[model samples]
Target: MNKLSLTRRAFVTSASAFGLVGASGLALPYYSRANQRPAFTHGVQSGDVDATSGMVWTRTDRPARVMYEVSTTESFADAVRLAPLDTSPASDYTVKRLLTDLAADQDIFYRMTAADLSDINAVSEPIVGRFRTAPASKRDVRFAWSGDTAGQGWGIDETGMKIYSTIAKHTPDFFLHSGDTIYADGAMKDEVDLPGGGKWKNVVMIDGKRKVAETLDEYRDQWKYNMMDKHVLALSAICPTFYQWDDHEVVNNWSDSKDLTTDNRYTEKSIPVLAARAARAFHE
Candidate 1:
């Protein structure tokens, strides 16, 4: 892989847009002088912000060295290249880095290229991310808590929409999402079985054939799909988030020893090792 070299002044003058490759996976439209379609794909995102710096992330499926353009606006026409970072398979083609010298309580815009040689195949959609430098003392801090965001019916739970919307309106300093933040395997309760089916199918397979969330990919997919909801995105974008999880993210009431019996009794068949891996991936 080639190391990316970037200059603040030059990047601002040459690139046409601003974006990043981060957790949000945001993508904005791009225009080119070429007659061919743009090749850049995948959205951009930023995370882990603080007073002096924050981490920016991006995703790319293209097979090549991808370079990201960081800026404060969609039009890189007047932006600066914070750094020319490289992407690799180890991190799932997602690029992340810490940025500095930005103002607090302000939004940042960024974009990326699949490679210097390849066409800027896709540009990440613009994201207005805020950086709130932590207060000197913790005594006067204000924060809120939320949790149990689960299921994916087109990336959102109607119940979650109402709750987060109401929460965002209040403007808290931060949010703590409690457990079960995502339910990877819980499908829509069978209101009525489909004509061709006896019951709904579980999302994943467990213990070789148990059909439950049992792998890291399966678990991450659950989080990715569910978090894609606009309301969820909006809440995270606007307020700093500190999150946690519960059994539904893996299996219902997953525990060790004893009969593992409870009112909402599940088979206790969850693979502990796999469940731990899934939890770690999501927490990251």
Candidate 2:
């Protein structure tokens, strides 16, 4: 592969950053295109397990590489770098590493730092999760299902909070996000940069200005934004999440052959049908 070089000035110009700052006081850029300096972006994920190995995934939306450290403790005071990984926009600015020879049924701690600089603030909040290795056999798993989190960007709403609380008390192993997890196209206060609320409007994008989302990236961003809610984040951390999609996951109502401008007749029926499909995907 070829390496791309970029200057710091040209980099921050396109970081397209977001998210709250931590005690570290770093400008964490959540996403960016190629040729931009990654504004302190990272994510921690664990999956694909066997007895002795599992995968650790992280990414950066910046123009440079990132180094990751995995450990068995939150402080990473005793952690070790499995290896250095290159980051780029092609993989959504992330990397997946296969860590081998780890003990089964034990918790592991993981954190990521950029390749060029060490910013403790940029480090993730110590993602410590257990390694299950593999299921012994077919077994019953209990979890909760909720959706239709229709609200604006940047949050959890009253109804959404209540449902999440209900799930917590039930104490299922995990939760299934059945569908309609976010109203990406719905207008809200944040949508119009108002103080409180805004009404739903057709997804729009203006030239030289931010556009209302009507594409896959916009829909994904809606999910990320919604999950930022403290309540939502707590629930996610407490339990594994199974997710699916609905029209609102991408638009208000859509189907295989219908456009956003399609008639209401098609929308009314297709929405449910597409909703079912999204649910099934979540299940699978």
Question: What are the candidates' C-alpha RMSDs?
Answer: 9.2, 12.6
Query: What is candidate 2's TM-score against the reference?
Result: 0.50
After superposing candidate 1 on the true structure, give the runs of residues whose Cα lies further than 4 Å from its correct spot: 1-53, 56-80, 86-90, 100-118, 121-125, 137-139, 151-160, 185-211, 257-270
Error of 2 at 3 (Å): 37
Model 2: per-residue Cα lDDT over 105-172, one tens digit each: 43455554553223222432234433333334556655678877645443343334556666766655
Q: What is the C-alpha lDDT of each candidate?
A: 0.51, 0.47
**Cα error of candidate 2 at position 270, Å:** 17
TM-score, one value per model: 0.59, 0.50
Q: How high is the lDDT of residue 259 in model 2?
A: 70
How many clashing pairs in candidate 2? Answer: 9
Poorest lDDT segment (10 consecutive residues) of candidate 1? 202-211
The TM-score measured for candidate 1 stands at 0.59
Which predicted model would earn the best TM-score? Answer: 1
Q: What is candidate 1's lDDT per residue for 1-284, written digit by digit as tens? A: 11122345534433333232334555433554443423333333444566445665545554344455445444555455543555555554555566665555444555555542254443333334432444445445566786666443222333435566677787766677777777755543323254687544333222212234556666655655544455666665556666566777766556664344552324444456667767665653
lDDT computed for candidate 2: 0.47
